[model samples]
Target chain A: MDLRDKYGLLIDDMADMRATVRIQLADGGLEKCDQARNVKEAVQKLSLRRYDLIVCDYNLGQGADGQQLLELLRRRQILPLTTAFLIITGETSYEQVATAAEYAPDDYLLKPFTADALRTRLTRILEKKEALAPLYRHLGPKGDPVQALAVCDELLAQGSRYSLDILRHKGELLQTLNRSQEALALYEGVLQQRATPWATVGKARVLAAGGDDTAAKEQLAGALKAYPNYLAAYDSLAAILEKTDTEAAQAVMEQSLAVAPTTQRQRRVGALALENEDYVRAEEAFKRAVEKDRTGFFKSHDDYAGLARSYSAQGKVQEALATVKDMSQYFAASPALTARQAAVESQVYAKAGNAEAAKAALQKALQTRQGGDLDPATQLEIAQACFTSGSAEQAKDIIRNLAEDHHENDQVLAEAQKVFARAGLGDEGGVFLDATRKRMVKLNNDAVALAKAGELDQAIAMLTEAADRLRNNCQVAINAALALLMNIHRKGMDTSALARAHHYILQARHANPEHPRLEEVASFYRKVAPPGTLILDDE
Target chain B: MDTLLATVIHDAKNGLATLGAWLEQARAQTPSPALEEACRQAQRINTQLVELLALHRGSEGTLRLAIADHDLADFVDDLKAEWLAPPQSTITVSWPADAGRIGAWAFDAYQVKLVLLDVLRNALRHARTTVALRLAVEPGGGIRFTVQDDGPGFPVAHSATMHDQGSGLGLSFARLIAREHRTPNGKHGDIEMKNAPQGGALFSLILP
Candidate 1:
């Protein structure tokens, strides 16, 4: 709780306000303080050095606010859990800061607060952070949730003052580790004690993860009614509804936007509206997503792509092409952007009845892909272009490969289905994607069964080939590593097999760091590997 | 018209806040009773502007409370820190000792704090020597905050309306904010005002 040793960062656009706050912070016993005037400087300072506390003004004066900066830092993992972030805002922006869906600051102080008030908030947040430091040590991007769970148990047993916070983190960790039943119980127990929005949404998420979508939807609906400002409930409900009812999902997203108009939510609403074929609404939402952030840091390629498609759908092909051109100017040159622009151009041209020009653009997009792998979004855009340019087989091949590579990624698979839907093949796309999913699941099951039946050599041969080809398929990589480890356990330790197992485990981790089976495979490696070998620690 | 009113109130409130910050800085550099009073008045105007904006939103049916979990002890501590005693006065304020035991409750801390501060300031003006703020769990569920002063009770004729009080806007704003803190099970918070058996006015804000 001593502020003398803590390092603080003060961010504000106004020089006078910064000086005033700097004096107040000094009055609060914080001597080692740094200042940043904008998001760029703030991020630069944060990346270079770690601070114990950050006090940021809400209005940063450049189309960037503290909330957006916090989101960026949190998403990029530049801000650690140990650092306390506080937002200073006027009454006008308090609701926006309060209703932040994700990446909320530790606390916020309204403007016109005195030095004592500021110190009290800083002290309280610092004290809580100190209490939960042990758990946070293992809760970073590269940290181990398995070990973090152990810390949670220890803290709970000791009756820590932050029991509710610890419980929240524990439930999230349980869900991440795929322990749905236990997570369900934890949430239910918390709900019985008192009604909390997070507990309600957490229970619904567990139900959804366990494939009880009906119950999950019902729970989320009730939670939303109770806590209308709870953005997480709206997000979860919209995600569940997206698969069954795009219109309803779009409505839910609109309600959330009414509560808090985040650019990410705008993109989501645009995507859902596009799926619902409400082209005008899609264009408006995507336009907001593109133009709201004049800083150009938060806008993604998907925003422009969504805007272009919405325009094309409404027979505004010229506007769509113009939007694509603006996208290239907004962002620096990159292969992904080139591929995305060309692919979207193909779709626009096809919609305009220029089949020859569409085919030429599709060839350009395909040539760009030959240089290297693009992001999944760009790849799916190319697949959609393929379908529009009279290349059905090529489109199917592209989607099939992507589906196999990201077999366990629901978001990517959903994007693939959207591509098909845009291509006027919704029903066929669902069936085709379902088959690809089943095929991938069966491949893993058969390999595991063969290994269990003592056909280790056959399992190894089957799994390694699949794992090597589908590098992004986490399940395949995990199984391949498991088979090789099992072989070494039955036979003597073959150095080559051990090395390959290590490689596959690391590959699996790279594919999905939070995969439930990762820790299990890692522990298995630690147990079977010889001493003095280079062991991969779960840092 | 509503948008214009809200925008003007917001800008005025922000201007007052900056003025208050400057006053505070000046007071810190060169302490004086006049600077201190100016700072307090600036803060008072800022709070009133905030209340007016909330009232505007309430009338327009756009008043949304950003309710979330807040530790009761920290909330009380913050209130105590901000509740400055009137200049040249000797009235003292006391808070509940059991706030730490209550843990956290879900409410809009910013708005609730303003409501309580308004009530506390009013009580300070009317109290003879002391004001007390108490916190306890409501009978069925939820939490209650009570602010009572030791002075002449509310006038018998205006006990219900309290129109003799300044503007009567604070009471209405308090009631609106209380009613907004509702639960999923069709339960809503309420505000109650009555003369305490001991001496003075007693106000209870219950949140579910």
Candidate 2:
């Protein structure tokens, strides 16, 4: 309960408020506290050294707030799970501070609190954090969820006072590990005792993951009615509805936006509205997302691209072109920005019947292809532009390559399908994407079969070629590494093969760190390679 | 109009909270009865402003509760910390022992804590020697919080019409919050006030 040893950070824009809270923090026995006047300084301080606690004022005087700061830190993994974050807010902003569903602070205090109250809250949160340290040690960005689940079991068996908190983590880990039935049972057990919002939304998530979309939708609908401020339910419902009904999904996103108009949620609504051909709504959503944050930390290239495309769909060619131009000014110079802007410009010009200019922009976008992989969205934009410029063959080539590289990723494949749909080839796009996915699957299966039949060399050759071509495909890279390791296991270590295996393992980790099979493959390399071989970064 | 009213009330509430904190600091440094009374009054006004703003939002149909799971023991400890005993009174407050055993429940902790604090303060005014708060699982479903004080029970007329009580705003706000807590099965929370069989006033807030 002692705060004397804990390092703390206090963030507030007002110097007076910062001084007041500093005195309070010292009075509360926390002497080693740093001060940050703004979000930029806070991020810098966090990157330099770790803190045991952070007390941030909700109103940071710019477009940024504590909630956004928390989201930024969490998304970038700049803040570890061990650090306790507490938000201080006035009554006017407490609802917003309280209902921050994802990346919520460890605790929040209403402003005007005495030092005694502050110390009490700090002690309570730190005690809970200390009790759950073992579970959290395996929970965040680099932690193993499998090990975290085991820790949850141990704590639960010991009758930990924070059993409810532990159970919440356990259910999420279960879902992440793809154990739907167990997660569903866990949620149901909690619900039998009380109708908690997390358990209600969690049960719906399990239903959705289990592919019972109807039941999931019904559960989410009921949950929203009871807990209308629950953002997670809206997000889950929209994700499920997006596959079958874009219009309904857009509605859900709009409702969530009404509750909390976060730039991320606004971008999601814009994208969904664009898909549903609600061009005006899309334009509004995207405009809000782009203009809401003057700091430019939360705005993404996707928002400007979405805004421009929506303008183009509504035949506002000048406005669309202006938005595309403005996007480059907001973001730093990068190949992704170059590709996204040019591709969006091509779409706008093509819509306005300027074929020559459209083709020129499309060529410029394609030139960025040699600079290495553009993001999936930018690539999709380029393909859509290609389809608009009377190059169906070129467009299909782009989609095919993307599909093969990310065959396991349904989200990317769905985006590819949307590109085809926008090109007036919905059914044909579905069939084409399906065939490409099947081909990628067959390639992996054939290589694995060869390896099993004692043809390690052939398997290695096939998988290595595919993995080399599809650098972003973690599955192929993992299989390639496994094949190399298996060969070394059978024929003893060849340094060349060992080096290639190490390369593919690192490539797979870079592509997708949380791939379920990543640990197994990495451990295999560790076992087969001789001592003092290449060390895995994760280890 | 609603936005303007709510904003003004919110600002006033925040100002009063700051005043209360300052008064508390002065009381701690100087140790005066007058500063103690000023702190109590400042907190009262702050609580009233919070209630008024919430009522304004309720009338505008914009009131939404941020219901989440909160550990009962932590919540009770928070309430105990925030509760300011009446000036020059020897009355003691008792908290529930089974809060940890009850584990956690879903409710808007901020508003609920305010409601319980108001109820406890009211009980302190009426209690002869002791006031106690207890937690239990409500019959049928949900969680219940009871505030009991060993004082003269509410008169028969006032028991039915709580408006006869001091200001009447606290009870109205408490009722509004309790009813706002609901379940997927269509059950809603409620507030009940009555004379306890043990010759004391008992108030309970049940949340689903």
TM-score top scorer: 2
lDDT of 1 by residue, B1-208 (tens): 3499988987787687678778989999999989988987887777778788888888997777776777888889888877777778899889998897877777888889999999888888889999899999886888899999988878888875662265878888899899878766667888988889878989899988
Work out the iRMS of candidate 2.
Answer: 1.3
lDDT of 2: 0.89
How far out, in Å, is residue A358 in model 1? Answer: 1.6
Tens digit of lDDT per residue, candidate 1, span A1-539? 77999999999999999999999999999999999999999999999999999999999996778988899998888998999999999767776567654667899898767887789889999999999999999786666888999999999999887888899999999998888999999999977656678888999999998989999998998887768888999999988888788899999999999888888889999988898889999999999999985455677999999999999999998899999999867888999999999999999999999999999999999999889867799999999999999899999998999999998998999999988887789899999999999999999999999999999999999999999988888999999999999999999889889999999999998888867678788889988899987688764
**Candidate 1 whole-model C-alpha lDDT, 0 to 1:** 0.88
lDDT of 1 at A213: 96
lDDT value, residue A87 of candidate 2? 94
Off by over 4 Å in 1: A100-102, A210-215, A537-539, B14-39, B163-166
List the RMSD of every prediction in angstroms. 2.6, 2.1
| TM-score of model number 2, chain B | 0.91
Scoring only the A-chain of each prediction against the true A-chain gives TM-scores of: 0.95, 0.97
The lDDT values for all models are 0.88, 0.89
Clash pairs detected, candidate 2: none
